[model samples]
Target: MNDDVRNIVLGMAAAGLSAALGWLARTCLWNRRLRRKQAFFGLPDNSESVLVVNRDAGSPDLAVHRYDVFALLELSALIKECGANADVITQDAARQGFGERTEFCVGGPGSNRRMAAHMRAMLPGMRVNVDSEPGPDRLAFQIGSERYRLEKGVGEYVVLARLTTGQPGRARPVFLFCGQTAITNQAAARYLYRHHERLARKHGNSTFVLLLKVVNSQAYGPDVTELVADVTRAAQAPLPTTAPARSSHRAP
Candidate 1:
């Protein structure tokens, strides 16, 4: 009887040990997958994120434009979803060292020079031009053969791009949301935040660029925005031997 009781106790201990090890293994595997999914959206858990906003010193009364504020809010919400926090900074405060961490640069070349520099380096084919005359509808963006113009009653265009600068294991990703006008900027930010999961599933840890069209510009904010094109594959393709000259014609 004593031998039988000892044998039964040993069997129960072995079973409990096996169950605990299985549970631990499953938990570790699940956590690894969750981290990979989060990284696919450029938001790794426990990582630092920065949202660079354009600062208009010319308009001292208004430190940051309303459109930039809207973009900041959208990005902040997304960062929170990633189980991390982001620090919001002005364009003037942004510097080179930021490339080491994940960053979201909001606004256009005319507004955020840092974003413009990165755009020129990472996306040589895309261009954002501002009319010298400066009118209500003088801003335009061009990508490949497609050109988008801002019209008072029609709508505006914005570019949302994700880029990296290192090898697969050590790459630093940056998200750029820019537009010729403030309304377009807001639209792009909203689109990225709303469709991040879908985009992550499609891109799967790759760099991508998207052009979004904001319809009913005169109406409600980003609610009317739509996807115009997915230029990721094209933008990532190697550029031609000779770069094409910038177009000067204003969009009709």
Candidate 2:
């Protein structure tokens, strides 16, 4: 073949490969989302007491979390479906040594903007709250139906449910959901956490353990019934306290 023709053919092949890879990646992500959704709504198992934790490291704050990002997205959708109130907060809110913290900061618009950008990156096409001239001491984002304010901070993935009574870290039957990279196996407990030891150590909010199956270690979207079973088993376990804590936080 002529040199130009050969080059053209190679370019076409590369483009085709790129397109295939993109499609495969998208499909994997979508399938994972669907599975988590099924678990969230009890579609497959008809269980309502399941708690989900999501883990992802693409945050603008780069928090250390437990589950995968995709799982969290699905968990959010699930919470809305169940008509339950859910909120995301910084892991620092769970820090032991920190005397006090503010949910909304008076002088942290820039941080809010960065957090918004991170959310946009993680969840494209979803409506985000980005205040250009936000009021002083404003929060960054809200999750689920209740519009509870969410702040970005260090650590792993967790969706804190607000308790009527004011208590810190007292949520019960806490279900952690996380979105793991199919290839990386880098969920909250995996190797991805090594990078954020400083933030995790600084705050005590990084103590979340998640369970997910390696769907694509060889073949993508394999059965997660066992993983789901594991989650159910964990949910069946008794929680430390029944009274939910007022400290709503998130780390993924």
Candidate 3:
């Protein structure tokens, strides 16, 4: 073969080999690393939590339903009803007008159900789930029930508060919060690292816990007081005293 033709053939073969190697490297070697990282972080194996969730869903203003917006709004309302300067634990409601008390986070690497368990153990009486699905805020779940539900496109906050008359174990009752609730309270650095160990134990990935000092203020809207009163009353009632009903915690 002519020298020029021979050189052209050799160049084409080299390019093909390079492309094949690159594809192999990405599919085999890099893929393994990704799987290991997921295991290390204890991230969910499902497409929803692991792949579908947009991690960078934070913004300077406004919040989304599946994101941290709902959590922020709910916590803000709670602060209004509980009175300012009261410390509270939250999952994602940090900064903005309403100050956060403290938070316990679960999910991701090092976050797991254990975090939820610890929080549950710490504050069994506070597992109040505010159901916002139906119009006119209502309280759902009674003692002995394990799961609770919240409405989509509805904004509300759920606090697992300890109703015991005395102080909680440790300096303050650790209010553990989770889910996509940490969008508004973006500046809770101190609270985020306080109980990280607990989060890590519960989840396989890096989990975060924030201990914030709840402060009193009019940061929340007018409907907060009524909602807070409703949930408190419902939680205090005996399990079988009344039938569980659907109620709206807020409108719009």
Candidate 4:
């Protein structure tokens, strides 16, 4: 072969090799990210999950709020991206036991009976005033010493939690996107989708609860959000117990 031809062929080979190596590197990085996300979400590849939603209060038919519905769509997309199929069910229809499937529950206690049960069972420290009069603070969410009240059009608080089902071994995860309003619920789900990597890094695919604040949502929508607090410990802490009435039936 001529010297010029040999040099050109060698350069082409080097370029092809480099291209292959670069592609391999990119694939490895992408696979690593996908694996991390799957681990944090506890969704095995090609698995099934539940997407529990709340029923609209004022709707004659069983219609959910547009914002909550949008949040559910975002959550559904996220779950699909994470390689799981979600079966969307309403709070009344979500009667399955936990520790079986990965769940993405949206809505506050007042709107979602399943969420209300979760509050009583899993997050006892969280007290939601659902039966109170209709007002800004009607559905106040209190944890520890802080009370989050909804100020319409201005600001609202949402609680996003990635927790276990309180099983003996909490291997399954349930992501809760709960808030005062539907807009805040959407914000909470968006925050989870956008910040799962950061959350996984900090919490390591484990149980965690966060309080997020949405500012001027009427103007900016659910995009303007800030982390108010990490209420993991407080939200899951057991509620205070009263020493029973001297055990009326002790050792009968």
lDDT of 4 by residue, 17-80 (tens): 9999999999999989999988888776898889999977557778899999999999889888
- Top-down lDDT ranking: 4, 1, 3, 2
Highest-lDDT candidate: 4
Per-model TM-score on C-alpha atoms: 0.76, 0.25, 0.29, 0.90
Judged by lDDT relative to the true structure, which candidate is superior, 3 or 4?
A: 4
List candidate 1 stretches off by more than 4 Å: 1-37, 56-62, 135-137, 233-252
Residue 160 lDDT in candidate 4: 94
The total number of steric clashes, by the backbone 3 Å criterion, in model 3 comes to 41
> Compared with the true structure, what per-residue lDDT tens digits does model 1 show for residues 1-252?
699999999999999999999999999998875676578655677777888898652475537888778888988887887788788888878875635778889888877888878877788777666555765435676666555666644677788888876556575688888876777787888888777768878876678899877777776777788777888765555445564454432223
Task: Compute the lDDT for candidate 2.
Answer: 0.32
RMSD of 3: 18.7
Candidate 3: lDDT over CA atoms?
0.33
Q: Any idea how many clashes model 4 has?
A: 0
Instruction: Kindly state the number of residue pairs that clash in model 2.
Output: 27
lDDT of 3 by residue, 71-187 (tens): 344444433332333233232433321111223232211122333344354433333333435433233223322223333224433332212223222122223333213321222
Local distance difference test scores for all models: 0.75, 0.32, 0.33, 0.82
Query: lDDT tens digits, residues 33-129, model 2?
Result: 5554433222333332322222233355545333233334444454554344445544323221111211111011122232233223332221223
Q: Cα lDDT for residue 224, model 3?
A: 26
